[model samples]
Target: MCNEMTTSLKTEVLESPLEIVLKGSNTKFITAFKELLLHPVYSRPTLQFIESSVKLAPNRARVLAESEHGRLIFIQLLKQTESWYSGEDNFYLHLLNSIISQLLSADLGNLFLSTFSEPIVNEDERLSLLKIVDAAIDSLLERKSTTLDCQPLLEILFRDFTTASAQAIPFIRSADTSPEYSDSLLSQLTNIWNRLIVLLDIYQTILDNQPSLKPEILKDNIIEELVSLLGEAQKSLPRRSKLADLEKSASKSSSGNVSDHDDLDPKDFPLIKGKIIYLLGTLVQENKQVQDLVRQLQGLELVLTNCIIDLNNPFIRERSILCLRYLLANNPENQDFVAKMEAKETVSEDALHEAGYETELVNGKLALKKRT
Candidate 1:
């Protein structure tokens, strides 16, 4: 009798619409959202759902922010538990992470961020939110997923970043901001910072492994997409700063205004700064292959160096310093330009602020000597 009852219940449940979709749906998207809200026992179905959703959405997935249905699905997914592992769920996690990133693209970022409320109730919730933010940064660099449509996503993400950064500031400088989460709120903030750094490192992987990307089309797409992604960071700055820097980078890049470089103003756009530095660093690694696009590349370097001097954040300054170090070390073509910028005090004297500065100096001098 017990066996019969269990079999009957299973039969009825199997007949349910949701279950039918789970079995028949090619994209498995139905279960993807459900898995987020359901138990980890449903991991297999959730993986199927993510695979299908990514297939349907691909690089241009409409961020759930604009689509009411999609938003509902996203909400469900955020409610998931640790049943999904770094092992079994890695594929789905990567896919979900990628989709969230697309959702946070510049065009859709604001909408996504705006949909969430301030002061999440717990660290777990904040960590989930942080995942999406991290994913956006990853998507920006990974697939070069920048489009005019992503601008809104980028805006909201920056707002999220600034707010998160604000929260993190106190903890970053605090004495007790250790790993002691047993009775501290700041510990949560520390977790957020650690997670963000991990995400940035993942994002940085795109530039670090740029040489491994296949197909010339994908490579080209990445370059332009990253450029657009950085462009959105301009919106986060003061209006006057934005407009002034806009006019300046434009004029400087166009007129080759080497003498009066200050004729153009600079903006404190951190995202842009990070993106530019990442791009320059990546390009430096493959400088020889990009000779055909030398003019545009030069313009990009000019803008980057100009922005590097204008950046106030030490982290950003460090990144820019590292990028310059790479270019000056591996790409001898940039030596004269670096010398010129150094002469003009556009790059700081404290090269130690950048990573690998000594190695860069040694390699740069070697490259210069070889040329001589």
Candidate 2:
């Protein structure tokens, strides 16, 4: 009798439609199946079933992403397997991972993007979606799937950064007056920054591995916008530092003792700053036009200043040095600018000319080179 019951149950599961199992009103079945889906022992078979179902009917899968009941299930599963990416054998996570892989493989980039971008009402739901998106991106990058178009995803990620920065800037500027509000803003900002870094790293990785794709990626103006944003953030750092010092002095005078206000560390902001510099380095590594653009925009100077400001952060320092190295690699004009800026003695135009190299405007920046 036990053997017969087990056989019947397996047959029932195989015959049931995935959509009904996922969004059905049978709470008992849903709850039991959810448990089974999350169980490490039973997850692989369950996930394989789901993957095959989705592959057979992608429209139904997309409808699931669009439906509230389906999204809730995804959110619940995502929360339950928060540590899934750490090599844990959670079935629900495996199922979701497999679904994402299938979607990318099928060249359903727009569907995935649209479904994931659904307007989630809850903050936790939104964050859960973000985490899911991040995992999907990692999987996509790992596969190096050539058929997948990353441009749309890149635009969405860049928009996320710009939107978050716009919201956080007001609070950042007025942080001295409203500490609590500023803390909240900074928390949001940090989350967005972390996501941006992940996305940018993925973007850089794709560009690095595929040389032919550079034209497609660079045509979007994403690099120029990123550089502009980086300059704006760097400009605000000193002002924020000065404001912090003033607030510290005021607190000390009023209390007649140095208040241990270690709540916010100015150093934390440099991690974002460093990531921006590193990304700039990645963008200009092989492109001479971009290198020349960075020179014209005084990006080199901004990077050099950051090297000093973020000296304690080895990763930042290393990236800054690499950026400088790449920027000056085949460009002598930028090299001469560095030399002139560093040297105490004034180097005349005549001296540059006498060195068998004359300054010529290349892409609107003076470059030193031998007369051709």
Candidate 3:
């Protein structure tokens, strides 16, 4: 009966989207609204109806989320809209975002997020879904959205990231094979890098909205993995940067799988590294527990090592210094650990100067260097 109603209404041929009108809450109304959205003109009304219907109340949203009719409407959204639409003012994109936000705020046993957490075979589909999920998380944070349960949702996000890391790190290893392999590695790395970008963006948004959750975020011993990954990423940077140039020299090849707008360049390691530093800094900022966590993991150097000039990553040096600051904030152990860290051999002043730093002398002796 439900399928029949949806098929009949969606099959209606209308000259204008304005022809459709949403009436009482019923199967026919839901079906007609799905068809109406096919034309962009009725998108706003459709979005409004979804916001009111699925998000009528948290309880109602959950109940509806469980209902066959509600599930059908939600499924229609995936078919009707694309999450990749750009611009701040696109209603089609806004509608997609609004729907995810409402579902998350309702949180029905992490139903909305759980769908995303599961393994997705198609990389493009996973990336698209992740983008929508990221947008939804932004809305939740903006509204200070709460739900009956969020830990499950949070855990799902973490798990999804773990999955992404597993998928991407193997590709990162391909960078070490040979210089000639640069083009293929860069193409492969884009998918991984783009996925990391959104996941990191989502994590930053979550922590930004609720600074108090920092301890909770670190309590799971996530810092250990993060520190290890940061080390892995740093190790890969110089190699990948070199490979990028080698790739450009060889050919301007392209990958059809990745989006052109993402500007997925091979040498963009600094961007990913910088984001990791920022996320770590945010997590450790004014939070003694996470600060100590970093100290325990011996990850302070990950941030400090990045405290150098890299033209590719515009503000990465500053971000690295800031992350170190957070790592050292009121933590004597971390401060001392950083203080004791030294180069394998003594550095010459000319070398420092060439690296864009002016050495600062303690009395008559040089103790530190600052960016000139």
Candidate 4:
């Protein structure tokens, strides 16, 4: 009865009048609301109010985040919600995520960074933090993918951000774009890539502190998609090299849209492939299910074959080897399977040559390089 009365009070009496009222520098209201959060029944509606208020007036995110009572409310709510967090989709979790997402989309990411500057209480909190960071990465990936029309990434690409950009430029048949626009687009894409790395670094820090959560983090199925991304990046490379030819085709055509190839290029992203490899390595390390999943995709060979020196990947060869070690460790079937594979025939090099390639010496050994 009390809960019902409180809900009614929130909906009827407080709804309109309190909406504007709450946004003020009212310490008492924030403190009292924090108390309501301690009650299960009232908490949900209260948090909903918080999210809705932020949604209605985006700047209130800073208002809510920076204030002492407001900060305590969020922290208390975060702790309180753990009791009911069933998975990534629970209501409380989603509400919290919505609020955070709103804040981030508003260019208020500094708030989250500031939140992290304080000491984290424990692993659960840190894991929550990591998953949240991953979500932010996903948002960036989504924006980045908008360029690819690719589903984008989900593919492993090289370390140097430029390689990803180079791979992407041809999609528009680079020759067709104004040099200025391409440079501008290139700059924007590089900025997005840099932000992604910063978030990934945050992920690494939390994971380093609580390594066991790697598999838990993998439950999102990042590996399956990224391995798929690798295949797409590799297969697309040949096609990208041929993108210049599309200009020839376009010149002959009367109809033109965003340049079928211009939708997004795999190389538009920087250090994408290397990032993909590193993320997957974290996911599959010491996890049999993920290892088997990679093995099943013929991903084992796919990965091994690409383990070559590429400037875009910097230490790609090394990273790939380490990832392979993780894939094979303690899993004898994968071990024996990999052991039986011929090093010379790991992947069909014919595809690379067909795409166009040149041989060169690298660190004193001859290596295949895409023809510049």
Candidate 5:
């Protein structure tokens, strides 16, 4: 009798309306799922429910597999497990974390991974999701209530970084092939790159918490790719328009004083040789490679200092100077290198050279040759 009843229930559950609801498109399902997810009881038990549902409704699993709801549930469950790890003893924490890790590892986080890899997704949709994921990852990383036993989760994110960076080259090259598509693709690519940096920052936080989980492979290759991608994106920017927009934006805010060159169009931004140094200075000052590479890019430093010194805008000059100071200050090993570069360029020289003249030399000190 018990076996008969179990079979009956399974049949009924398989034919249920909820299972039917899961068959629809991902956007619709996520909309409905969000209500359930926000409710305390439903949200907390989501993982257990999902696991069981997948077993009973294999078809529903595929639909869920493609849905935002699925990724949301997975991320939420991982975070909740992190919370449980703090209060639970090592034995149970290890066991639970292991289970969560296995689930994410089985397919290398296929559900979350699939969302970005969707061939049908437009660049606009991709950009929107990237922003959403960035915020979600940031919130997850900031959760102090949770223990950081999430190596599997971090690995999944690392995999994402790898795939995104690989696809970027093709997208960038093809972007120009279609102007309308290129604009949207460029916007999407920028968002992806920005969010990856944000995600990398979170990944670094996890390593700080659980130092043993740092992947040497990622450190060696993935980081270099990330920096290279950022440099490439900066180069692709419409410099004149972007700088004009940046100046206008900067002026509205109280971050610093306005530049005399602030009113100057973006086309005038100095280009050195074949390299675009536009935001390389910003990246050097901001990225973790600060001590490692930014300090070493003293030619970049010279370029930035000269650009700022001649600019009419006080704000732009101050920002560039501040960045230079940071690159020099961050690494002890690079300090001597910075000092040597500074000493050599301390004297003002002729403006006849392409990079502009050092207009003033005071007591053997180099200064931007004032534009007469």
Candidate 6:
């Protein structure tokens, strides 16, 4: 009778939906599964079983992602786990590490990307997902051993995010008339931009802690696309008159609320542009190939132009200048490029001087000559 009951229970669990098992409370199976998840032994078979289940039922994994309880449980486990080197108390960390590896193997990471690509109805929930994904990335990056495989996850993240951002650019450029419509578009753009920032943060952390990961990041064409996006963003900044019109409309509104026009703030454009410049700077700071690529793409000109235009904003100007310095640093081709640009400017000024006008370098600086 005892053997028969055990077999029946096992059969019942096998037949039940995966999400129910994951999200259900206090059942014998859930308690057992939770133990397996937090198991101290890194090579336990039960852990493998759970991983296989997720792999086999990736749609169920998406279901878990959609559930607040499921997400919180997973995040809590990750938070409680110390580093892998934390001796005997590192069970949760070990389990999470394995779980991430399994998720990648099962192609569930692609499912996560697909879910992320969908329209986010809840901003807080979307942020929670971002945090969970970032945590998984952090866990992989924390490994001291060389065996961890983070490339696949990184690739999916980069490809999906860039593609999504590219898709959003057109809607942003359109700048729809309805305040509600415009706000929605800007919110989408902001969410995508924030997600990109999170990814870039992970990349920077990897580069800082594990220099070997830099090549994998660079080879993905992420930087090239980011530079292109930055140029487009700069070109799309709202004109001063358009901003004034928005201000006038805001002032005339009965509710006396300018919240609708918050997304149209001219300053936000420069801030986003500055961050892109900083990202480019970070990418090229230690990578010669990226430096060459930036030069080949005429990124130097773009950075310089933006720097000049936003000189009044110290942060924007500083970031742009730093990016230019990185792109040209020890780069002979880029140096020559800058030198030619300066030479052309000099020739133009000399031509004016030759036309019977006095030109002078005040304090060794080029200054326009006044007709005297």
Candidate 5 local lDDT, 46-158, one digit each (tens): 34445555545434454444555555544443434434534644533343333333333343333544554445354334333343444433444466664434554555566
Q: Tens-digit lDDT track for model 1 on 1-372?
A: 333333432454334433333343333343334533364444445445544554455433343444444554555555452233334646556656655654544245455556644442244544565565655565555555453233333334334445544554444344222334344564565455544443344345543544443233234334443443333333343222455655666676688764432332222222334544555456655454442233243543443443343422324455656555555555545655555555555655455244343213453442122221
Q: Could you estimate the TM-score for every candidate?
A: 0.41, 0.65, 0.68, 0.41, 0.42, 0.53
Q: Rank the models by lDDT, top first.
A: 3, 2, 6, 4, 1, 5
The sequence of per-residue lDDT tens digits that candidate 3 reaches over residues 1-372 is 334444454454222121132222455666665665564556566566555554545455553345555555555665444442643567667766766666666555367555433341245555666787787777666664353234555676677677767766665555445345466656556656777888888778877776666666776656776776677777665522455653553353353433322343453443677778888888888878788877777677667667665544546767777776666656766644543453322333343343344444456544344454
Sort by TM-score, best first: what order?
3, 2, 6, 5, 1, 4
Quantify all predictions' global Cα lDDT against the true fold: 0.45, 0.59, 0.59, 0.55, 0.43, 0.56
List ranges where model 4 is wrong by over 4 Å.
1-22, 25-184, 237-268, 347-372
Give the per-residue lDDT of model 6 (tens digit) for 1-372.
333334443576556666776676635654454554455542244444445567566456655456654554454344333333345745444555556555644456655554444353244344435545666666655766524455556777676557656765674455433234466666666655556556656565656566676677777887788778776765665433345654565475656664433534432332456667777888888567788888787677777665533421236656666676676666666655655555456233332333223345557644333346
lDDT of 6 at 146: 29
Cα error of candidate 3 at position 146, Å: 8.4
On TM-score, the leading prediction is 3
lDDT preference between candidates 2 and 4, better one: 2
TM-score of 1: 0.41
Candidate 6, position 356, lDDT: 28
Candidate 2 C-alpha RMSD relative to the actual structure: 9.1
Cα lDDT of model 1 overall?
Answer: 0.45
lDDT of 6 at 33: 46
Highest lDDT scorer: 3
